[model samples]
Target: MIERLENVVTFLDKYIAWMFVLVAVILFILLYLTYQCCLKYCARNLSKRDKPRHYRSSTLQYIRFTQVVKTPPRLSTDSHYQTIPLPNY
Candidate 1:
């Protein structure tokens, strides 16, 4: 058992860097696939008009109104700046 453990340790020591790289590549692929799936799901939902009854909740029903007001901009008269003194710590 000790000999087997030593052999395994030696193998791991030699290929630990490669193992890290392999794990990173696997994680990147997993995240990319998840992102793609999320995008596809979002697109599919956005393209369809008919949604499930559960999705047709009353919370989505609301009235939205926008009012645009035209206002004149105020111009600054004085160019002089005032400086305040700070206390030393």
Candidate 2:
């Protein structure tokens, strides 16, 4: 009877281990799918074309402004600040 009980216990241990492994695999798959879905959703919604026209125009304006700010003003022969011609957006 003791031997039979030991065999049963060993079987149960293996069965429980396999069950845990299966659960872990399933959970991992679910998590990966969820992450993929979130990435796709974000990419779709955050695409440049999906943005509002005003938002895109404002962003371009900001970029132009930054470029103008980055350029150093040239000094003329008279040591006066030369006016930089700003590009029309």
lDDT digits (tens) for residues 46-79 of candidate 2: 8765554565768777677667767887667775
1-89: candidate 1 lDDT, tens digit per residue: 99999999999887997899999999999999999999999998874544434434543421110011113334445855543332222
Which parts of model 1 have CA positions greater than 4 angstroms off?
1-11, 49-89
Model 2 segments beyond 4 Å from truth?
48-50, 53-89
The local lDDT score (0 to 100) that residue 60 gets in candidate 1 is: 42
Worst 10 residues of 1 by lDDT: 61-70
Give lDDT: candidate 2, residue 73: 72
Go through the candidates in order and give the clash count of each.
0, 0
> What lDDT does each candidate get?
0.61, 0.81
